[model samples]
Structure formats: structure tokens, C-alpha cells
Target: MTSQNSRQTLIIPALGGLYARLNDGVETLLRVIAGGFLAVHGSGKIVDPFGASEMVEGLGFYPGAFWSPLLAATEFFGGILIALGLLTRPAAFAGMIVLLVTVWFHWVTMGQGFSGAEKSLLWAAALAFFVVRGGNRHSIDARLGKAF
Candidate 1:
């Protein structure tokens, strides 16, 4: 049987060692970027939390007033939590749900299909990763020695 070291070397002999050393940092970077972009994307909604009421209602979310603000908070505050790696799993799960809704909205509601829902699809996948992995050693969860 091929040892782990040999398998890694066989894949990329030259950069394998570098990749191993930077794997955690790279994971941290992915988390930060994903969370940061999510926060930025929701920043506008946060300012006018109720502005999406009509949109939410259109998606069959009743009482646009409540759902709109909830969506805003889930995107804005949840993104912050994910970025900080605090409550990472819950935050990511929330974000994933939001992204999935967008996917449906674009793909089925708007009839844009794959071309329109592509970004939401990718974002959902990324959040799914965090939902499963939580934060890494560089995260606040790690520093606090506790994670949820």
C-alpha cells in the first residue's frame, strides 16, 4: 500500500510540502473571504432591513416585514459570526439556507436556470463546507477552546 507521504508526493512532488504547511492558512483564507463577501453582500439589506419585504413575499415567505429583517440579520450578523469563526457551524448553516433560497429564486422563480443561479450555487457549496468543517486552528473558536 502506498503511504500517505508517497501519495502526496506523487500528486505534486515540488509543491506538496508547501501545500501541507499552508493548508490551514488556506482554509482560514477561504473562510474569511467567504464570510467577508457574504457580509458585504448583505450590508445594503441591513441598512434597509425591511426593503426586501416584497421580495420575500414574492418567494412565499409570509409577512414580508418579519422575514425581510430576519433575512438581513441572517446574512449580515451570521456572516460576521462565520468570519470570526464563532458559532461557525450555525452561521454557515444559516447562510447556506439563504443561498439555497436564492438558488431557487433564480433558477425556478425567475426562470434564469443554471446561468442565473450559478453564483448562489457556488456560495451555498462554500457555506456547506464550513457547516461541516466548522472553523480551523486559526479561528476564534480554536482560540477560545470551544465551538458551537
Candidate 2:
């Protein structure tokens, strides 16, 4: 090819346009899936006293075992925010932290594999995307004049 033709091809918009679309599709799916998973996990804590208390003790997140309600609330509300694509950057950051911790837990019990640790890795990647992208378009933040 000529130099000019090669330059045009290099800058062609179609050069992997399909792949970019696929990535967007995957991102949308992850937004839904991660949001739903977080909602359920938070709801579980609310419904199960034992589970909540056990989490407080097991995780030792609080200085003096101040109950798991704080974490539960973060999960539930953060999930909702992410689902609506409102305040997505902060929500995704928090969700990424949770996923990373989950990965550590799975690594201990489930060992290294696609069935366990890899799930957390993927969750981290998805959440990180939202954190960096801030929910692109068609999000609550965008519709409400607050997408950032």
C-alpha cells in the first residue's frame, strides 16, 4: 500500500470498531450483574442476623466490632447507585475494593481458578472501568446533568 493509504488505514474508524462495541456491551452486562450481586449480598446481611454478626467478627473491619450494618449499607446503596449510573466513579471504587477483598477470600479457600479468584478479578476490572469512564452515556448522572 502507498504511504498515504497506509496512513488512512491506520486512522480508519473501522479498524476494530466491532471490538469496541463488544467491549461496551460487556461493560453494560457487568454493570447489571455486579449491581445485582451487590444488592443481593447486602440484602442477605440485612435478613440474616447470624450472617451479619459473623461478618463483623470474621472481617474485623470495625475498631471495636461495631456491627456489620455500615458495610451492608454501603453494599446496598452503592449497588443501587451503580445500577442507576449515579455517582458511578465513587461507587465503582468502593465496589472494586470489595471485589478485591473477595478475591483474597476465594484465594484462600477456593484456590486459584476461573471458578473462584478469577471472578473477583473480573469484577475488579468491570468496576474499575466504571470508575474510570464514569458511566459514559444513558446513565442517571448524565440524564440528571451530573455525569462525572
Using lDDT, give the best candidate's number: 1
Q: Which residue runs does candidate 2 get wrong by more than 4 Å?
A: 1-26, 48-50, 63-67, 108-115
Model 2 worst lDDT window (10 residues) = 1-10
Q: Per-residue alpha-carbon lDDT of model 1 for 1-113, expressed as tens digits?
A: 12666554355577767867888898999999999899999999999999999999999999999999999999999888888898899999999999999999999999999
lDDT of 2 by residue, 6-65 (tens): 455455567555655676566666786777787777787656534565655665555323
Candidate 2: C-alpha lDDT: 0.72
Off by over 4 Å in 1: 1-9
Worst 10 contiguous positions by lDDT, candidate 1: 1-10
The TM-scores of all predictions, comma-separated, are 0.93, 0.70
